[model samples]
Target chain A: MIEARHLSKLYSRGVYALRDLNLTIAKGEFLFLTGPSGAGKSTLLRLLLREELPSEGEVTVAGRNLSVLSSQEVQAYRRSLGFVFQDFRLIPRMSVFQNVAFVMRVLGVPVPVQQRRTFQMLKWVGLQHRMNALPDELSGGEQQRIAIARALVNEPQLVLADEPTGNLDPDLSLEIMNLLREINARGTTVVVATHDRELIRRVGRRAVTLDHGRITEVG
Target chain B: MAALRYAVEEAVASLWRGRRSAVLSIGTIAVALFVLGAFLVLTVNLERLAADWSQAAELSVFLADEVGADQQRAIEEALATGPVVASRAFVSQSDALARFKQMFSDLAASADALDANPLPASYEVRLQPGVTGEAVEELASRLRQVPGVADVRYDRQWLDRLLAAVALIRRIGFALGALLTVAAGLTVGNVVRLALHARRDEIVIMQLVGAPTAYVRGPFIVEGVLQGGLGALVALLALGVAFWATQAPYLVPLAAALNMTAVAFLPFITAIYLMLGGMLVGCLGGILATRSESR
Candidate 1:
C-alpha cells in the first residue's frame, strides 16, 4: 500500500514538479499514471520511491513513513518496492543472470536463495534460456522482459514502472502491459507512468492523469 | 559466501564495464610506485652503510719505540683509566708489524728491510657515543701527554663527511616519497573521475533503487583496491627491472665507497602499505566523484 498527503515537489523557483498531490493506492491494485511529457509523472514516481525528497508533506509505502525514515531506512523501504526503468538500464557488459541478481546482491541476500529465486523468476518471464545473453544480444521486447523479470525478482510489495512501454511498438506495448497486470494480480500493487492514451483507454484500469505538474483528472 | 560472490561478481562486472579506464589507471599507478620502490631500496640500504662506517671509526695512537714493555703496559693502563675513553686495546709491536704487512705488502717489504720492527706498538681507543668533537680532540691531546705515548690521532673529518652524506640521502628520499604519494593520489583521482563519467547512468539507476550508500559505494571501493593491487604488481616489475639494470655498475668498489650496496629497496611492509595507499586514494576519488553523480 502507498499513500501520499499534501505532497509537493518544487525543483526550483516557479518549477514545481508536483503540487498538493494527495493519493492513496491500495494493495494489489494496478494503476496507470499518464499525461503528456513533463507532466510530473516521473517526479511523482521518484518521490514515492524515495529517490527524491518532497518539498512538502508525507509519503508512506507499506506503512513506513518515508519522510521520517533516515537514508538507511529509506533504502530498506525502497527494497520493498521494485522499480523498472524505461531504458532497461541493464549494464550492457553483464549477462542476463547478473543483471537480475543485482538487487538481491545489493540487499545482501544469500547466494543459494538469490540464484534460486533469480532462475525461477527468469523462467517465469520465459527467458531462463537467455540467462547468459548480454542485453545487446537481445531484441527490444526481450530486453524489456529481462527488465520486468529483474523488477519482480525481489518479490517487492509495490512495483513502480516508468514508461515501461515507451520504447516498444503497440503490439509489444500491450504484451508488456499484460505482463504488468499479471504481476499486479500476484499481490503486488503496480503504478505505471506512461503517455500512451490509447493503451490506457483500451486497458480501462484506474488512470491518474497529470498536466503541467498537477493531477488534473482521474478515471 | 554470498557476499564474496557478490563482491567478485560486482568486481568483475565493474572492471569489465570500465576495462579501458581500469587498465590505464592501474598502469600509471604502477609506474609511479616502481620509481618510489627503487628509490626507497637505495635510500634504506645507504643509511645502513653510513651507520656501519660510523661505528667503524676508531683512533690509532702509536707508542714510542724506546718505551720499555712494562712502560707500554703502564701507558695502556693509563689510557684505559682515562674518563674520556670508553675502551682501549694495545697492539704488540710484532703484531702491529704483521698487520701492516698484511695491509700493504709492498710497503711492508720495504719496512722489513729496516732491521728492527719498523711499526711501533699502539693503543686503539674508542670513545663513547655522543662524545663531542672538541672533547675528543682535547682528550687526544691529553693522552699525548701520557708517558710512552708517541702520538694521537682521530678521523673526525671522515666521520662527519659520512654522516653528512647519509643525512642528505635521507632528506632527499623523504621529499621524493611525499611527492610520489601526491602524484599517486592525483593519478587515482583522475581515473576514478573518468570511471564515474562512464557509469553515470548506471549510478543513477542504482540510486533510484535506493541501494544504501554503502551498497552503491562498495563495488567502487573494491574496484579501487583491484586497481591498486595490480598497480603494485606492475611497480614490483619496474623495481626489478631498474634494480637489475643498475646492479652491475653499482656493485663496484666505488659503489661501496658511496654506500650503494648497503642502501636496500622498499621493505616488505612498506610495499604492502603502498598498495593499500594506492587503493585508498582511488577509492577516495571515486567516492567524491560518485557523490556528485549519485544524486
Candidate 2:
C-alpha cells in the first residue's frame, strides 16, 4: 500500500531529516514505525501525507507518486486517507459531532448522510453521548477516540497516526491502540509512528525501527 | 451545496467572533457608498430638471421702444421664414407688464408706482422639436443683427451650461466613488486577514485533513461579501432618510427657485446596482485575503 525508494529529505544548511531510506508495506497491513526523537519517523509520515515535497527520491502510495500530485490532486489524495495527530487537532470551536462530520462536509456530502455517518462513527468509538460536547470538554481518551472516529468517518483506505497516544496515560494509550487494531481488522491499512517499544511488542505487528534517519531493524 | 452551506455558516460565525472589525469594515463601506449615492441622487435630479426645461426651450427677442411698424413687419417676416421657429407670439409692452404682474403678485405694488411701463415688447419664439443648441444660438445671433432688434436671449444656451455642470458633477461623483470603494475593499481585506491570522491553527488542521481550497478559504470570502452587502444596505437606508429629510425642508424650495417641478430619489434600479456593487467589492476583499494565505 506504501513504498519509499531512496527517500531523502534535506533541511537548511546540511541538516538531513531522512537520508536514503527505502521501505514498503503491503495493502491492509498494520505497521508501526518506531524511532527516537529526530529519527525521521514523523518526517516519513509527512512525506506519505504529501504535506511537503521530498528533496530527493519519491514516496508512492497505491501506485501514485506523492511528489507529482497537483494541489487539487493532493487534496483529493489526502481525502482518500485518514490522519490522526498526537494533539487530536479537532477544531477547538467545533462540537464532537461537527468535528467528525467536517470531513464529509468538505467532501460535499449531504447533511443527512453526514449526520448518519458521523453518528455511526461516534457510536463505534463510544463517544456518541458526547456529540454536543466541545473538544476542550472531553477527557484525553475521549478526545483521542473522537479523533479516531473523525479519521474513519470518511471511510479512508489507509490511516496514518502520528504519536496517537503521545498525550494520553498508559491505559488510555492502550485503549487507543486497541481501537486502531479494530480499524485495521476491518481491512484498512494502518501505519503508526511512535517510540513506544513496549506498545509495539504488545501489538506484535510488523514493526520497523529507525535510527539516525535509516531503518535499522524490521520484524 | 454542502460546501456553500458550510461556507455561509462559517463566514457568519467568523464575523460574529470578530464583530468589532466587521463593524468597522462595514461602516467604512457604508460611508463610502453613501457619498457615492448622494452624488447619484444629485445628478439624477439635475438631469431630470434639465430634461424638463429642455422641453420648453425657446428664444425671447425683446424689441426697442421706438421700433417702427416696418421694423416689426420685418422681424415678423423673419420669424415666419425661419425653419427653426415652430411658433411665435408678439407680446406688447403693456401685455408683458400684465404677465409679469400676474406671475409676481408681490411685485405689483412696486410696478404700480411707476408712471410708465418700462417693459419692452418681445417675441416669444418656440423652436421646432430636436433643434440643436447651436442652431438656436446661430438663429439668435442672426436676429441680433436685424434692425430694431434690441437683444436676443435663447433658453437653450443656459440649459446647455446646466447640462455641462451636471456632467462634471457626475464625473466627480464617479471618481470619488472609485477611490472610496478601493479603500473599502482594502479595509475588508485587512479585517479578513486578521481573521485568517486568528484561525491559523484551524486552517492548518483543515489543510492537513484534506479540506478542499474552497472549504478552507470560502468562509473568508463570504465574510467580506456580507460586510459589503450590509454596508450597502445601511448606505441606502441612510440615503433614503436624508432624501426624506431634505425634500420638505430644502429641496422643494430649491426646486421651485430652479423652475423644476420636483426632485426625485435614486431610481429603483440604481439602488439595486449600488447594493450589488457593495457585494462585489466585498468579494474582492475576500479574494485578496485568501490569495495571501495561498502564498
Per-model TM-score, in order, reads: 0.84, 0.91
Cα displacement (angstroms), candidate 2, residue B98, comes to 5.7
Clashing pairs in 1: B41-B264, B41-B265, B45-B262, B45-B263, B45-B264, B46-B263
Candidate 1, residue A132: the lDDT equals 98
* iRMSD values, candidates in order: 2.0, 1.1
Superposed Cα deviation of residue B104, candidate 1 (Å): 7.3
Model-by-model DockQ, in order: 0.54, 0.75
* Candidate 2: CAPRI quality band: medium
Please report, as a residue range, the 10-residue window in candidate 1 chain B with the lowest summed lDDT.
B256-265
lDDT for B115 (candidate 2): 95
* Model 1's TM-score against the true structure: 0.84
Residue B235 lDDT (model 1): 83
Relative to the unseen true structure, what is the C-alpha lDDT of residue A151 in candidate 1, on a scale of 0 to 100?
A: 87
lDDT of 2 by residue, B1-295 (tens): 6678889999999999999999999999999999999999999999998888877888899999999999999899878845689899999999999999999999999999999999999999988866778888888888888898999988797888989999999999999999999999999999999999999988987887788988999999999999999999999999999999989989999999998889899999999999999999999999999998779
How many angstroms is residue B30 displaced in model 1 relative to the true structure, after the best TM-score fit?
Answer: 2.9
lDDT by residue (A129-182, candidate 2, tens digit) is 999999999998899999999999999999999999999888889999999999
